[model samples]
Target: MLYCKDCQLLCEQECPQCGSRSLRKPQANDPVLLGVFEPAIAFGVESILKDNHIPYEKFGNLGAAVTLYVGTAMETYRFFVPYGEYRKSVSLVEELTGPAEPSQEHE
Candidate 1:
C-alpha cells in the first residue's frame, strides 16, 4: 500500500487527489498551520491576539455566498504569525484557555 504524505491519504499507486507520485514528507522547519476554524473561533483567536499583543493575519477561504447559504461550501480559514513570534503567540493562546476554573466536584 502506498500513501501520500503530503495529503495523508492512502492510495493504490499515486495520489488521485493531488496527482503526485513522489510527495515529500513535511519537515520540522515547515511552518505549522494552527487550524481551520469557524467564525466564532476565528474572531476569538483575533481577540486573543489583540489582548496578548500577538500579531496575526487572516487567510480566509470564504467561497461563494450561494454555496455558503446552501451549507455546501468547502471554505476554511487559516491564521499565521511570523516564525519568530509563533512560539510566543501559541503560548499566549494556550495560557488563555488553560485551567480557568477548578472542577465542580473540587469546588
Candidate 2:
C-alpha cells in the first residue's frame, strides 16, 4: 500500500478527505496578503494554513535582475491568500505571527 504525504493520513489510493493524489501536493493562485514573514516563521505559517485548509501562495526572490533591483532580491518572502478568503487567512496569520501592527500610509 502507498502512503500519502499530505493530510497526514495513510490511504489506499488517494487522500479521500483532501482529495490529493497519493504523494502529490496541492497548488493554487490565492490572493490577499497573509503576511510578509522571514524564513524563520515560514514553517509555522505554512503549517497553520495547511491545517486550516486555507489556500495560499508564497513568493521569494522576486527580482529578475540582481543588481538592478536589490530591494527585491532574496531573503524577503511573502504569503498571499485568495481575495474571498482574506478574513480567514488573516486570522490564521495572526495566530502564527501575533496581532497585526498599525502601518503608516505610503506617500
Candidate 3:
C-alpha cells in the first residue's frame, strides 16, 4: 500500500478517490486517520486510546453553536493517530467495534 500525500490517505495505486499519482510510503510521525464516527463510537474510541496510552486527536465537523442548538446527534467526528501507533490502535478498535470506515471528505 502507498500513502497519498495529497489526500493523506493510504491507497494501493493512485488515490482511490482523487486519482492522484502522488503517493509514497507513510512516514512515522504522519498523522494517520483512524476513522470518522458518531458520538457513541467516537467516545468509545477515545476511551480505548486513553486506556492504551496512545496519543490521538479528534475533530468535529459542526461548530460549538451548531452543536449547542442541534446537539451531537448530527455531529460527526474524525479521529487520527500518528503512523507509528496506527496499527496497534486499529487492532484495538477493530477488536471491539470492527474496522472503522475511512474518511471520504478531505481534511
Candidate 4:
C-alpha cells in the first residue's frame, strides 16, 4: 500500500495489475521539484515543469483542486510522489534550490 504522509491519504496498496506499490512519478529527472511538502509547493513545481516543457503530473490526494485548497488551508496534508521518480525529482529540485541536507531528504 502507498501512504502519502504529506497528503494524509491512503491509496490502493498496490498496482492493480502487478500488485506492486512501486508506481513511478513522471519527470523524475527535473531539477526543481525535490519534494512537494504542500499544495503551494506542488503548484510551484508544476509551473516550473510546465515552463521547462517537462511533462509531469502531481499524484496523491493533493492533486485534486478541492483537496489542495482544504489541505493547504488546514495545513494537514501529507503529500507524496510516485516511488520511482522520487530520487530523480529530488535531485533536480535540489539543483535548483540548493542541496538538501541529510535530515531534509525525506521532507
Global Cα lDDT for candidate 3: 0.83
The deviation in Å at residue 11 for candidate 1 is: 22
Q: Go through the candidates in order and give each one's C-alpha lDDT.
A: 0.55, 0.59, 0.83, 0.46
Query: Per-residue lDDT of 6-43 in model 2, one digit per residue for the tens?
Result: 43333456665577774533223324445667667777
Clashes of each: 0, 2, 0, 11
TM-score list, all predictions: 0.47, 0.54, 0.84, 0.38
Give a tens-digit lDDT track for model 1, residues 37-83. 55666677778878877666766665567446766344455666544
Candidate 2 C-alpha error for residue 42, in Å: 1.5
TM-score leaderboard ranking: 3, 2, 1, 4
lDDT of 4 by residue, 1-107 (tens): 34433333223554433345653333433222234445555566666656655555555533467655665553322324444555555555665556766543231
Compared with the true structure, model 1 gives a TM-score of: 0.47
A best-first ranking of the candidates according to their lDDT comes to 3, 2, 1, 4
Residue 86 local lDDT, model 2: 64
Query: Can you tell me which runs of candidate 1 are displaced by over 4 Å?
Result: 1-32, 64-75, 96-107
> For residues 1-107, what per-residue lDDT tens digits would candidate 3 score against the true structure?
68877656777888876898888899987877777778998899999999999999898989789999999999999888888898998899888787656644454
Error of 3 at 63 (Å): 2.5
Instruction: Name the lDDT of candidate 2.
Output: 0.59
Return whichever of 3 and 4 wins on TM-score.
3
- Residue 30 deviation, candidate 2, in Å? 6.8
Alpha-carbon lDDT of model 4: 0.46
RMSD of 1: 10.5
